[model samples]
Target: MSIPQKLFSEFLGTALLLAIVIGSGIMGERLAGANEAIALVVNTLSTIGGLYILIEVFGPISGAHFNPVVSAVMAYRGLLPRASLPAYVVAQLAGAVVGAWIAHAMFDVSILQLSMKVRSGTGQWFAEVVATAGLLLVILRAPAARVAAMVAAYIGSAYFFTASTSFANPAAAVGRMFTESFAGIAPASVPGFVGAQLVGAALAVAISSVFAGAPVATEIEPKPNV
Candidate 1:
């Protein structure tokens, strides 16, 4: 498939994700009312479910990356072509912005809420790195392990636990600026988060390549303290 087609897929897929993000974030914020854990749970489930659906729907066209982090990792590992990278990023970002707009319109809320900022300290940054790393690692190494189920579950689960909600896609990270709800990423913070996610994805690409030719390391089994 052409990169443009894939890029379009990313655009649509991420739009769907933001729609969910906005709808869920607003509902959760109102329902949870300062309960961080509940808000987190709601956001995670929405993200996981939305991603699962988007990947299935968009995979045939653009491999449904929906996330720049995923694309960067895939490209780093030779799964995606270098030429298509820029197009994919542009399409993904455009889609995200549109998606955020629609989401805000649907809820009849101020778009500024779409640009809502979260207080991130050291813990959040490290969490973003770890979360992105896990997501990239699973996608990169899955075929080797023959884990048929890992494909969707990896991303879904990563978003559930990731502090950044695993914004793993730079475009979506930028697009999310449209919503000021719980899922929103401030314009100012987008670059930093995106950079960190890229770093995490790049590391995964290197690690997967190192293990590609060599067999994936397996542990020796001892008879459970028998």
Candidate 2:
């Protein structure tokens, strides 16, 4: 796929992600007695299901990296083209903002209320770090380990088990700020979370950097048939 088209697919996937994440959160709130944790897990699972489908749909085209961290790690593994970074990030973030707005409109929430996090602070930050690191680890290690679906499943399960809740795409972090919702992160906290995810991604890269020059293609050239 062309660069613009790939980025456009990423954007649509991200927009869909926020809509599902936040929209499900709102649904869970009403059904489960405003149980924030329950709501988050429900929404997280919804995202996992959505991403599983999205990965299949867009993975062949753009690598379906809705998260900047995922894209960065792919670059680190020498799987992605460098020039695609800026456009990919921009598209992902813009889509997230649009998604957040759509969720708020559907749920009738205000920005301040939307940005109000049910979870935050130091512990949450640690959770964010670990969760993101784990997610990137899964993605990077998946194909080689022959466990792609397992990795995606790991992400969903971790979000359910981890305190951080969102394990948000770094780009999605920027986009989610436009509205106040269960899935939205506060604008004040975006910088810290974004930094954490990037750091986590970098750390993942370092951990696997020893294999930096490892051969990626498994296909071998055929010798002369003669």
Candidate 3:
């Protein structure tokens, strides 16, 4: 694919991902009333479905990496050109913010609001580390054909298991910071979450190197322009 096509793919995929996450959270919260658990279930189910579809649709175009950590890992492993890393990260981050705005527009909420939801502390941070690490592990090790399903499934599971509800993606953390909705994480909390996520990503790289042997070639690998 051409550079423009690749960037657009990444931007659109990441934007839609945030839209699914934030939009579903809003819808779920409104429909579930005071039942937070029910709301969470709804959010998780929507995310799982949306994430799967996005990966399948965009993987062939841009590797469907909506997260900076994933992009960085791919760059590190030479799956993606190191020279392209900055552009990829910028695209993803911009997409995330736009996605949050899109969700707000859909729900008729304030588009410029900042998240006030506090997500902090040692347990939550630790959970983020674990959540991010596990996510990278799955991405690195899962077969190409099964990656989309496996990733969605892992995220759904991590939603309940992790204390921070598994905001494992730094782009996601940044995006959610823009929303005051159910899925939102306060700006104050973002740095810690991002830091923990980076740690988790590094850990995953180390662990996968030992256990997964060489990186498994996948359908998501970027193809050269014809």
| Model 1 alpha-carbon miss at residue 122, Å | 2.2
lDDT per residue for candidate 3 within 56-114, as digits (tens), equals: 99999999999999999999999999999999999999999999999999999999989
Q: Give all candidates' CA lDDT scores.
A: 0.71, 0.73, 0.96
The sequence of per-residue lDDT tens digits that candidate 2 reaches over residues 13-97 is 8888778777887777777786777876677778778777777777777888888888777775678877777788788888887
For model 3, the local distance difference test gives 0.96
TM-scores for the candidates: 0.82, 0.83, 0.94
Residue-level lDDT tens digits of model 1 in 105-140: 877886555465853666567667776777777776
Clashes of each: 10, 3, 0
Model 3 Cα shift for residue 115 (angstroms): 0.5
lDDT-best of 2 and 3: 3
Measured by TM-score, the strongest candidate is: 3
Model 3 misses residue 144 by how many Å?
0.5
Task: List where candidate 1 sits over 4 angstroms from the true fold.
Answer: 112-116, 144-152, 214-226
